[model samples]
Target: MKFEVGDKVVIQHSNDEGEVVEIINDKMVLVDVRGVKFPAYTDQLDFPYFKRFTEKKLFPAEKKPKKYIDQLPPEKPAPGKKKERIAQLADGVWLTFLPVFDSDEFGDDVVESLKIYLVNNSTLAFNFSYTLTYSGNSDFNLDGALPSMQDFYLHDIPFANLNDNPVFGCDFSLMTPDRKLAEHYEASLKLRAKQVFGRIEEIRKKGEATFSFKLFDEYPLRPYEEEKPVDTLGLGKLAGSGFRIYEASNGAAAYGVGEERA
Candidate 1:
């Protein structure tokens, strides 16, 4: 019955499959089916993977093997060219911008595409929603959770759009696993337009592999502060032995003692 957001499950009554989006309580959860979300009890859901194994018969169905084309590895920059840079956005989160190049049919001219990655590098897991903005009026959204030490690919931004909308900023709202609903932490990450665009142009002219920059390395989020422990040692002894107060004025002195009469 254990479940968390992003886990795949099959609904009991409908027998439809979907991902767990929100957990209401010990017995309830919300699931996303296609684009619609429905409330379902935890007891009514089963692991989708297990169902596939249970439904398969002893005899395997005959099917033709599908051929897959091997993808070429990303091209590497020349030895002297700059390398890729990874930037830390918040406490356990990292960001990086990359340019991927493609060649024309003749393999003479090059085309460029941009991609941004947001990585989770902390011990704790988190669910997050993000907004990336540029040009002052344009924006895009990427919503999902990244488990501990995982990575999420944002999207491919076309090279043509960079000129009109150069500078970019990202805002993220994250909820940690321990206090998923209690605390909503926010972080704002900014990437300068000049830096990115200049590098791209330089790499293009130099025929380098790609352009990269390292910014805001391991920037930390505001940490949670725990309460201090109470002092109990001396207080217990002082309560048992009571105390005495002595006052002196000029040459005259007065003394008072207090203790448990019993």
Candidate 2:
């Protein structure tokens, strides 16, 4: 509602979620991130957004129960908490995300649809739209297949692949446009996938699979101010096709669709 000169806030208008780097006059505060500065009016803002962390893991020589892992507690312990830390680290604490991924062999495809569901659903609203394009390459693998990285996401929240297919899913950076919903949604998504699929990794197609759509992010109907162009991303160099996110607003994002700028 109100922003002081030095408050760290996330702009709901866009997902940049930068710190309130400086106050410019009475009406605007400049948020700077990654060497970029954006000035926004106080009226179009929210403050004190949540922070995010890369997922970490802890392990002790003994064994931790699946229930504890299943719980997916918000406060993850370090490699050790007790002398336990020593024991956990002594033998060697290997942070293997693949181990968790390896367990869910069955939900591989489900993970795909789930992420598509979340993104599509979340961006369905009138305020914003997200599109998934290929930036560097098209196919994640030579076979034109995706990594199948045990696609898992939360429920209640919505997501979609602009092209209407999902293969690899990514994390929502902390200052996501809708941080609260994204976090809760991702948590529930993580916990539920772990529970239902178990740790075993397997691939199963839930519904008919087909490439029905080409992914695209919506551009502003008309540009108003400094935020000039929209951004897009493509698959990547590995896939042999390149795309970038582009709109009248952000101009062109590094990633989009096809071999050209989307």
Candidate 1 overall lDDT versus native? 0.59
Number of clashes recorded per candidate: 0, 61
Candidate 1 residue-wise lDDT, 84-176, digit = tens: 113223445665555655666886534355767666655556666767667666468777876655556677777666656544444443454
lDDT of 2 by residue, 74-144 (tens): 87666832211100111211111111111246534233222122222112232221222233333322111
- Measured against the true structure, the TM-scores of the candidates, in listed sequence, are 0.39, 0.19
TM-score quality measure for candidate 1: 0.39
Number of the top-ranking candidate, with lDDT as the measure: 1
Give Cα-based local distance difference scores for all models: 0.59, 0.33
Q: RMSD per prediction, one decimal?
A: 19.3, 28.3
Q: How does candidate 2 fare on TM-score?
A: 0.19
